[model samples]
Target: MKRDVTITNPVLQGVFPDPSWMWHNNEAWLVTSSFGQVPGLPIHTSRDLSHWQRRCSAIDEEMARRLFLKYIRTDNHGIFAPTIREFGDAIIIVSTVMEVMVDKALADGADPDEINRLRAANGNFALVSRDDGLTWEGPHWIKGAVGNDPDFFIDADGTTWWTASRPSSSPRWPFQSDIWMRKLDTERWRLEGPERIIWHGAVEGATWAESPHIFLKDGTYYLLAAEAGTERRHAQSVARSDSLNACYYENNSRNPILTHRTLGEGFPVQNVGHSDMLRDDNGDWWGVCLGSRVVEGYSFMGREPFVFPIVWEDGWPVFTPGDALLRRRIIRGQENTRHGYQLGDIASQEGKNETDRDRHIEQINPNDYLMLPTQPQWIWTRVDDFDYEVLFNPTLMHEARIQQNRDVFASITTDSDSSSVVACISNKGTVQEIGRTALHHDEWYSVRLVGRSVRFAQVPAPNCIPNTEHPLLVGKGAAAVESVAAGGWPVINGGLDIPDSSFAYADAAFLSTESAGGYIGCLAGVR
Candidate 1:
């Protein structure tokens, strides 16, 4: 037996939500939702539970184009929660491509006639990987497997059952849901047999009962689910039954086995739920779930994946150990420490220089980049700063072009299509362009942007497009654009030092996940 080691809560960081865990060949494999990010469905492998390395995305370029290209128009609109499991020699994944109805339409009192017409592309599907998730095949639409967070339960007798969250036929309230199950025909890739509604939720009037997983212990079937709407009241609960297809009774004594809602607002961690349980080689119970780290009433990194220890007591699972709530740190038996990977903490750590080995940086080249098999570094967001480090004061430099005066281009910009090449800043969901400029089109030019101002220059090139005359460099009125960054938002400053108020100036915090308001943080990628 190995001793327990105290490890950080989120083993995988930066917007990795709804993690599905499985142990294969002594290695831990996990997958998370990408939610419309190209080359979606990221797969991560870890030998030591503490350190995880991204292997690849399950949905490749071909799959993305064929399945999600046209459908994925907005953030959090693509891949929902996914469940990965080992069946025989192959590994299988069951998930939903959530093109579900948007809430805004309902709020605006859109015609009900267009509701189903708009939700035609929403459903559950499965993918298989014979070579250990390196590659995948067939979305093999699981017809009739409706709803979100589809999970697989492989019985001892080789029966594979599928369960998912769906709107209850007998709805007691709006957004009320139920967990249902049916036999999955792996060969035919569809659901067969009578559908059984297993559990509603632990709370009396809980809404959005989702992310259900089943476990068989002794002769009792345990059904674990996430309920309470996945917001401030998000929580995990369990139910049990004697027969596989029988009615499951909620663990009335200890229904919500895990949650941090009781901790109130501004706790270190909040929105904890959507857990998946797995037994280790040492025969100990462990679980993985999604949680958001709150800072000043905002979550910038979105919901990240967290791993914790669980214990079985009186036929129900207990989360953490001494404390029944989510913890910033927890202890777990250390096993399989072969893979030595650690996430760098440049943003939090002190005394780390630009060239310091502790500094974390990633650079992406767009020309050679392929949308399929997207490298783990490529994530969805407004701007992702990889190797480009902007600790307190930052500077951004890049080459850009504008086809027309109506089209604006500079070293960096919130929107390249905006008419003016000006200094701009966004605060509280409002964009203000401070500086304005005009430049020649179909030409190559160098651009540099700092916290207070921006600079541009026209450089002649041979093989590249024609050249043009651009406005000279200058500075801004404010000596330095003061900035405060929480999480990974870069604080850029110091391109060409000149006093000019025309360039855009902004506080780096204005570009944080708090301001963006979505499931993903700011991502640095060429689009």
Candidate 2:
């Protein structure tokens, strides 16, 4: 008897979100929301655009420098969902952005009441880069609202159009979304296109419409929108328009074409449809979407990118439902290797830290993973996608040492700093500050762990950060296990269920304030 194995599609894995794509000349250029992770748009350029190989990130430190003062505030904008296009000789993309800072209300007004109220809002907006998207101009004003999971389309007649979800638009209208529209203008930096209310939940509860894209095929303008919220499951709905000027109505079915139950077999993804569709050289349809990885059977991170294949049926689109639990190989043996990447072993250790350009560390996850600056892009917290004002750099971090517990190691690391500094907090939340040390460059660095003993030195590339503390040449030493367990951090509930025991795994990242003014990357190497 011959046995057969079913294969899944997204050959590559991670928490990918808000899929966006562009077909340039003969190459397929695409962008995705990297989320709190540094580096905007995990752009993969493909000759075929089907089988993709990561090339370079569209947004990075250097690019940030060229455009930092132009679009949105650097510290607060962790490049949200962006839209890209080819204008004349160059390619461009704009980001819906938010930056953090002390409340303007506080500065402008004498009233403490009004000032405190304004501080709580996380402002969302649109930013554009005229210099081929490498350097942007401004997040200007596209109306103040929670505009995310946005995208744009170029009309054949040369008019540029836009779409995004006003996720909170339903508070008053029940099932309504501000499917915004605008024209692309070169003379002016921001969207000069006259904006309008293209669509609202005219059908069912468009409760949360996301990633709305407009495409033309066979003289029909097909508008595909992801309906339902991000968790549970997401479905795509389609609407058609005979003219760009005419109002496009929702497809009567008004339901999701795909569901988590269909895609998430046993362990399929919960929600799956803030998608951007792209066509490969071969003409096959593909989409990039946002979903969570749900480690430990619980949702932790906000949303990530999910790539899948798309099929068209009589003017509508369809996607393959995934399994609840992920199957090892999305596609087996077909994983042809170009440049191989390795995720090495990690361990919990108490160590001294040092960094310089030459002294760098690797991330435990895929080396390609990068951390953004602490001011904005790399927002972190006890909250998801937190703003910049509240998110500070962790040039220094604190932690108390408990029993040599296998389950409590956190993967942590800093950007490739010419010099690095980090420390620990004791059981009493007492802070220990480690001064600046030269960072190792070229390859990623890591902590050398041997049980309670820890040393930080330059390892090759690709690894996570260590969380234990090491005393300076002279000072208070690491506390006892009982002291650590008492109050440092509540006894981590599942402190014994990690998949790896041999090597301690680390992923907690807190950046340093030193990299604030200049152009330095605060990268995260996720395993």
Candidate 3:
């Protein structure tokens, strides 16, 4: 028998979270949470789960401004989990525009008028696109749907069911929540009929039971939900019942079908939850979920989308069968390709040189650049030895920062007069500048890395900054490292671990989750 080939995990990288998967038109489609990122509700398509490409953002500028950006208040406060489904002649998406709490806003002395406006704008809503998401219609605020992570389920008899999670109407404990359902009046664009609690949770004292998705198979209703919040203790559990509106019982044998909470903080993939499932053309079950790659307790990259193989036994789903923990790689075969999938060598191809890699880069039209929102979408290259000249257009004056993970390795502020470089590190939430240097205006400069030391020079002439004799900053100071470790987080002693040890950088470890101090990852891009 031929062995399956190994492929990288987190198929969709760089902070794509709350992934919802569905099979439509014989292809795999996905939508993930956008938080504060604009041009929100990104839709991705994959012929085979192994290789995926972005189609277009389902939420456009007009919709984004009207529904989310107008009232956005915090970094992780907008655009929560979105569920995409093919309904009738159009594709519909159900999501929530989360806003600051009214009490908190009032306490902060926010204008009552604005606070009321924000409150009116917040809540769960729906959008439909008939032209493959090129155009959209109706943010039709679902009148009765209350809570986050709402999902749409169309029953066999053509009845539409809306499922969501919210704090219990009458709470017995703190953070107690329940999953409930109601008949969705699709034509009227609102939820109709009486609401009923379907499942409390899989376990006692489970908190924040949200991200509810209902799956029906063989005269049974399987309700999947995420509980314990989306943190180190995040998890996904299942409950089942014969009827849609009746109470469901937990799958006690395997309550939490998936989670990384039991693996401890040392494990690489942490905080795994908010999962969605689908079956491929080959009838094989697969799943996608949000997880983070934690390096020494710091997860700077934030929650990313990871794919896993799933199997059903006794009417329940098993994620990554036989594996207790999420792996960095998985074994797959080419035989599992979808209907129109042309198998590629992506799984086994040798690494390409940068020049060879550039050929595959998608070229975006210059006009389309205007439509691009100011999100931290980045292109990264990791290396121990790099020599490149960066031309900072004097007229633009855009401030760009260089990072070695969460640490601010250096920053360049350019203006018409001249540019200055500041080498810095972040301690707790405070930024401390370690050194500074000045460069001639409109001059081409080269930055090179030799081991842990970063050197700067004027191009062609090789004149170093200040005078021609000194390197910019050597990795000599341990004060930054000491301060960071003392700040009460696990510190990776040696440098950042490059999975491929072909390169090494000692201070790369400083760029981590603890140092970043936000829900999002350390970003490197021009704003």
Q: Point to the candidate with the largest lDDT.
A: 3
Question: Would you list the clashing residue pairs of candidate 3?
Answer: 406-511, 407-511
Q: Give the per-residue lDDT of model 3 (tens digit) for 292-377.
A: 75545656456788877777778788776665455545656545543222223232222222113221112222222212232333
* Per-model lDDT: 0.59, 0.42, 0.61
lDDT ranking of the models? 3, 1, 2
lDDT of 2 by residue, 117-211 (tens): 32222333334444544455433333323466555567888776556677454356564566766664434323554556566543545666666
Per-residue lDDT of 352 in model 3: 24
Candidate 2, residue 396: the lDDT equals 27
Give residue 29's lDDT in candidate 2 (0 to 100). Answer: 69
| Candidate 2 regions with alpha-carbon error over 4 angstroms | 1-12, 35-37, 48-51, 62-77, 102-146, 167-175, 190-195, 201-203, 252-254, 261-266, 299-302, 321-369, 375-527
| Superposition TM-score, candidate 1 onto the true structure | 0.71
Predicted candidate 1 versus true structure: per-residue lDDT over 1-527, tens digit per residue: 47545556577766678888888787778899877665577888775576777777888767664454334445546788999899799988888876633455456565454343334425577889998877788777786677889999898888999999988888998778989999999898778999888888986788889999988998888888999765679899888887888756556568788888887775556788999987766666678999875444444446788877777778778876555655445445535432111122333432122124332222222322323122232222222111121111111222231100101122233235653333334444354555545443433233323332234333333232211221112111222212323222223333335443333433343333444544554332222
Query: How do these models rank on TM-score, best leading?
Result: 3, 1, 2
Error of 3 at 216 (Å): 0.8
**Models, CA RMSD each:** 9.3, 13.0, 8.7
* Residue 456 displacement (Å), model 1: 15
